[model samples]
Target: VQAGQRLLIEGAAGNVGRKLIQLATAAGVTVVTTSSARDFDQCQRLGSQACYDYQSGFGDQLVRDEWTFDHVIDTSGRVALATNLDLLLLGGEVTLITAPKDDQFTFGVRAFYMAQKRINGFVISHATVDQLARAAEVLNQAFSAGQLLDDQVSQQHFSDAPRCHQWLEDGQDGHQRFVLLPD
Candidate 1:
């Protein structure tokens, strides 16, 4: 993200969202987030300029607040594609790491193209070597600046590997990064 651009992160309580906030804010981007009310303080600590509860018609709230983003990183698929399409500023993009498994998304192709807005999915493992290198440089810089989100890391014994996997699959404990310690 370029300096002075605005970005929105949905599921700001998630690990990726938190880390993204730190990185985006460090780069001088205006960062806003959507999450549960309980995570507002944590999101703020991560440098989000504002946090809206995703369950509470946050799309409408954003419109009312006159907030539009040049980019959006969606970690959770809770926000439908249509709504996100409407939220973008001209020539904006929405990058999705995850999305609904069973639903088919549709948007007006004409309007999308006319507005110069776009959407795409991202899987870091699938990134090209050059792209990865660029991302690593940024990640290293963030880590050196102490912007890395250590709080999202939770150490667990290797014996708990099964449990950790279950937790991730269940998605019931919210988002966290596992540091599996050797047994």
Candidate 2:
């Protein structure tokens, strides 16, 4: 929430990305978010100072002079590492939740050194008890404030879990999140 700090969040429409936007905005950081063209309006409404369509050749539109971020969070993991590094100012930080080339040791090592960037790798399983408690508290606050009320969850009986997996694998759900219900 440092004044005048520009935070660019990649994958700004998904769950983690959306939460990042809300928290950063609440803390008074100037936030820019990237998503598909269809999700731009949603991201903007959720408190992004600006929303860019990542699929629309907008990455090239962000020249060094036009946009420089103090922090970049790559939630999508689809963007090129070089491009993300170019967007950061000196001594800036970059975080990635996913590494597409994890299996290739040489490529991963080269990519890290080439960026001249401090790269952080993350996995949800790394959340500690304290972190989980804090997340729960935030969710409670959001619910109390009516900001967490949305019909974004689709309930499926346990028997349909296999179908749900198939749907996800087939990319049929889009923004839908499925929840399983025990019969």
Candidate whose lDDT is highest: 1
lDDT tens digits, residue span 1-183, model 2? 266688899998888888888778876888998888788888888889778888866567767238878888989877776677778776667788877453332225444466555767777799899989998998788778776454389999999999999998897887778889997
Q: Which pairs clash inside model 1?
A: none
Per-prediction TM-score to the true structure, in the order listed: 0.88, 0.79
Candidate 1 lDDT, 1-183, residue by residue in tens: 699999999998877888888888888999999999999998998799999999999999999999998998889887888788888988999989986553888888888999999888998779999999999998888778777845757899999999999998998667667889998
In candidate 2, stretches whose alpha carbon ends up further than 4 angstroms from where it belongs are 1-3, 101-117, 128-139, 148-151
Clashing residue pairs in candidate 2 are none
> What TM-score should be assigned to candidate 2?
0.79
Query: C-alpha displacement of 87 in model 1, angstroms?
Result: 0.8
